[model samples]
Target chain A: MLIALLWYLGAVIFTWALGLFLLWRIEKSGVKRWGATGRLFTYK
Target chain B: MQWYIGAMALYAAFLIWTNVKSLKMAESASDFTAGGHRMGLLLGTGTTTATWVSVASVLGIPAFLYSDGAAAIIGWMAGWIFGGALIPIVGYKIRRPANPARTFPEFVRMRYDMFARRSFLQALIGVVMFIGYLFLVNIQATGFGIVFSSITGVDYKVAIFGFLIFIVITNVGGFWSVATTDTLNAAVIAIGCIAAAVTVLLSTGGLGNILDTLAVTTAPINEGGPALDPGVLLTPTGSFGSAALLSIFISNSLGTPSSPHWVARMLAPMNVKVAVLQIMANVVVLLVIWLPLIVMGLGAKALIPSLPEGVATDYVIPLLLQEHTPVLVAALTLVAICAAAVSTGNSMLLTCSTSLYYDVYLNLFGRTVSDRALKNWLRFIVFVVAVIAVVLAIDPLWFLAMGFTYVYGGFGATFSLTVFLGLYWKRMNRAGAYASIIVGFVAFIIATAADVPVPFVVAVSASAVACLIAVYATKPPPLESYEPFFEAEISESTKVAVERVLKLNPAQQSEAVEVRSV
Candidate 1:
């Protein structure tokens, strides 16, 4: 139970951090037509 | 029966409000379908989250958790987070100026070619999605019967009929109505789930006490190890195992983009930025709502030694809510559960109805259907489909989770590949598009019909492989024919959407448009 709980916590934190990091990079890359930051949210 | 009838009345009132509100706002076909692109941030977030969670998450996830333990919760969350991460990259990217298509079918036709192949692909997707969801659809109906019979003194048939009437009423409002109600439903689901989870967790003491009790009560049923082992719930890779998690993430992330029902909601977003933000917001909301149910399930196993045979596990949450919680909380929780079911049901009915009216009736027949006429047609279609679903719900044999997996998974694999490739790769032509659809549909059927070993994996994998092979085998469309479809950059509204959401300045945002034409 202890080992599985630790692993679950680690997986979640790492995945979220990784996703946010990718999001930051994608924002910086300006790969799409929108500006680096412009790609993040829908600014209606 | 009282609880069941109470749920029905509440749902019916919600439907009347939604339909009356929508009728006042709807002025054109676009308004009926996309709510005139004015849906706000909260509504967008709430509806998207609520609609996607469905009975699959509400019932299936908890049921699995009760049987398996905490590990199941981890596995389920892993799928949601991965799917959440993937959506912004693809779903948002596709909504730009170069291709502002409202529906998934339109995207396929534009990105690929508008011919026999794309049409066939769309029809195949429609059929599979409808059939795939039938299992859950029926289960939910059966659930209604069970809940009603247990709560009220009345017969089961009344509960079923009441549910059907509720389905028809909300469904009549089309996309506009569904979107509004979905937002309300999301709130209800979140509150209901949290309430149930908290009640169950407290009733059984803390997590430590629950585990302590489980330790003695649960012994290894077999040499296979502890029957109560929490490890079974956690897939390898810390969360759920990679393949299972990946299957979930890929299937859902891709599926939402290509789903006619979901993208139709996107069209109603006040702007592009709202759509992207809503997807992110949905991630948070889903976690909050689903996590508690998992905890409740695990707690249930510790408290109740064994699950009763022949009882559908999906009702476990409701059972706990009714058994353990105060009367008022139980009532609201029932509202929440019904909210979860009705929100998705409304969306499904609306999507199927719109497809019948716009894509099949008008487009195929080439009839110049008026907007008012189309709305009426959509209402009629909803009524017919609801009646059919109600009838199917009466049958006990319907398997909701597996059925949804085969049907929805197939659609996601086939259409997503076509949409992504067609948009980015100009080499894809009409012939290739047709080939991809034919191969995908046939492969899906073949994989599922024979109960071919590992149907989900086989069907999804087959469709994916067929798309690539078929594309490579076919000739490209003429360059001249494809050129008009390619715009140099995305639309201003779409760019504004990207810029605002991504928090980009005007000059920095221009970089995103660099590859628009290419």
Candidate 2:
């Protein structure tokens, strides 16, 4: 149970980090051109 | 009963009074719907956070844990990050021009044409969303009944009426009142959820006891998918597996950015940067709320192995709190649960009322209504929606979880698509916007009625296709047809206000400039 619990917590933390990291990498790559189109905030 | 009912009533009265004060401050329809477009960053963030917290976070997430194991929490929380992450970019574009469009529907109308704007398709989409939101509101009301019943031993119907009356006070005050109350509700929820988390952990006799109990009685992870393997967490495809994890990612990322509550939140922020910060605030809140829910859920698993099926799994958290925690701690958690339900209900009722009064009634009947009459009509619409929600809450089968999800996904996809595409694809015409509204809504109705095995995936997939069809089917109108839409309504002097929102840059400024020019 503890292992499963830790795994659950790790997955959430990992996802959050991954999302932020991806956002950073996209910005670093100057790939804001691929974000949601026609709206403001360039990443799409 | 004494603590929960008394505290909730007092809080409800306080919220109504605050909302009324906001109503007194509102001087026009724009002021009513958008809080005079002069909201401070703190209040703006507070309102956005409060409204978006909804039952999904409060009850639904905890319930998911009980049923689907830890994997369910991942899916629910992913939406917050996805939705929040994507919004700043959206906000930076929309806040600049400060055009007169009040609702997502109005944006669709402008980007498409009157046929799409005022068409049956648009209104029908609103109807589906309203029904879904209404069902969600009733479910929250039902939660009130459950909380009240758990403590006081009163009938569920009585609790429903008491809650309905409490919510009605805000209707007269309208959006301003909803915002003020929602901010207060958000505060209450943060404190209550954290407190409940701590107490539930202690009551469960700590991590040692929790694990000992789980070792003895934990159900097999799945019938065929590796029985009782805690290592299911190691493989992405184990018990909960990677498939469930990916589902969470897809649903939250695609679904949340499109929610009406979120879009409304985007509208409330003082500037684009503030809106982006608001999304970050959502991430913070998710962390605070979900951590405890996950712990408590695991505790519930260790303590009570059997919860009745088909009852919304979200109810398990409160049920656990009521039965397992001490009386004092239980009462506080009850308030938190009620606060969660009310937060979403109040926001939904407010948003739905605004849509009916501003988007539908005003669009259709305002031409015949005097200004004074319109104010009365707005108040009336608020009352009507609240009363209908109350009745539905009491009626068995009036509320369903999936109903709300489908409507939210459908309407969100429909209007959000128009707003996103219109801003970027200069070729997305009024014709396409109109078609999207019709097809998006029709697809939603079909999905809602169909008993498909995977309704969420089906509804979203079908809706996306509808949006693309709408976009591609019509030729873009000549540049002249869209010229009026590009103009900025904000005075040049307001550039300082715009500049303060740091997420935006000069190129983004040109986007707003394009909105003004179109």
Candidate 3:
């Protein structure tokens, strides 16, 4: 049970951290490519 | 029971409010179809996840996992991950054109100028999209019927009517309403799936106990049947033969970029970056949620070794929640299932209506309706399609009984090859596009009717060969014909010269120029 719990916890944390990091990288590159006029950072 | 009713009542109220709010904003066909291409990352991510997950993820995956073991994940989840990766490669390029087409058929028509106006190809594509959405609607209705009937003891037929009422109300406002409500639905689904997973995990003594139980439990066989092999369930082959599994994986991953509903999502983002990120978010959410649900499926097997003999496997998730959780938690979980169904249904309905109204009704029929009139026509088409879907759902064809593999395979075979080749390969012409769609579609139908073992692979392979032959046999279109798709920004001289060379009618020339300037 302890191992299972740790595995689940690790998987969830790793997915979130990795996903957020990739998103940040993509957004930074997007802003560089198109600048503020592209509305990459703006919400609606 | 009362908690379930209360939750549904609250959700219905929320749907009604969103409909009213969005109806005010949805004044043009563009807003109704693609939210005027101004959707932000937050809403785009939410809708993308909500649309992709569907009831298939919430209900179908668990059912498969319950019957087959962890191997089901390879066929379904792996396909999703691979398909999500292709979004940047295929979908991003298609969306990057200066004058992005509003619908998939429109995109095809514009990209391949041979069928740009008044062609059978556009109408045929629109019909296929409409039928596909209808199939999706019926699937969502079936999911609703199962959850509603199980929870409230209402007849399944009666429960579907109740579900359809909510779908129609929410979709009356079109894409804006769908996107806003999808954000809320995505949150509900994420939270509810996690909560249910945690509850099941705790009750079943965690993932370790569940895995241990699954390791020993053998599937029961009827008389005169071969004794079941427990080993196959844990491997990638599972009950499906290896060839069939590979075909399913290819179909799911490769076909997704061309599915009309998903293609519509690619059109909703404000820019190419947002589109790419939205798909990334979908992948992450799917990965996080699916693992827990797989665990829950194993946990259910451990807790209830055998369901009642006649009970369908689709009931596994709901039955698990009802057995272990408190009334309120179970009720909330059921709401989440409904949200999954409703979200997908709304998106499919909007896509279907867009295809009908924009691709076929207006474009093919040569209607010069005003913008306001077009919006009204779209709403009416939505209502009409919902009614037909509801009637069909009443007698619901058990399409999913055959597995989602076939459906995704059909879409992928028909559109994937054409869209990918058309965008990347300069030699691709109208003949190739037509041959790919027609041959792929026909091959899929014939193979399915004949019960071929690897229908998807055969269909796609045949289509690819046909496409190659057609491309080589025909003369390539002029270099200027490909200019719009290749260039980031069209020069004034090139636009004027191309428009004159194509000899587009006055209306089309102006519309093309307008899209370019936007």
List lDDT for all candidates, in order.
Answer: 0.58, 0.57, 0.71
Q: Write the per-residue lDDT of candidate 3 for residues B291-317, one digit (tens) a residue.
A: 677777767777776677667777788
* Candidate 3 clash pair list: none
- TM-score of each prediction: 0.80, 0.78, 0.88
DockQ of each: 0.26, 0.11, 0.13
Per model, the share of native interface contacts recovered reads: 0.11, 0.06, 0.03
Candidate 2: regions farther than 4 A off: A1-44, B114-125, B207-216, B219-249, B308-312, B366-372, B395-404, B444-473, B478-518
Identify the leading candidate in terms of TM-score.
3
The candidate with the higher DockQ, 1 or 2, is 1
Let me know the TM-score candidate 3 reaches against the reference structure.
Answer: 0.88
lDDT of 3 at B372: 62
Best candidate according to lDDT: 3
lDDT for residue B394 in candidate 3, whole number 0-100: 77
Candidate 3's residue-wise lDDT over A1-44, tens digit each?
Answer: 23333433443444345444544544555533221233433422
lDDT by residue (A1-44, candidate 1, tens digit) is 45434544554454455445544544665544322445454243
Chain A TM-score relative to the true structure, per candidate: 0.63, 0.58, 0.62
Give lDDT tens digits, candidate 2, residues B25-82.
5555544555544555566666676766666666665655655555554455554555
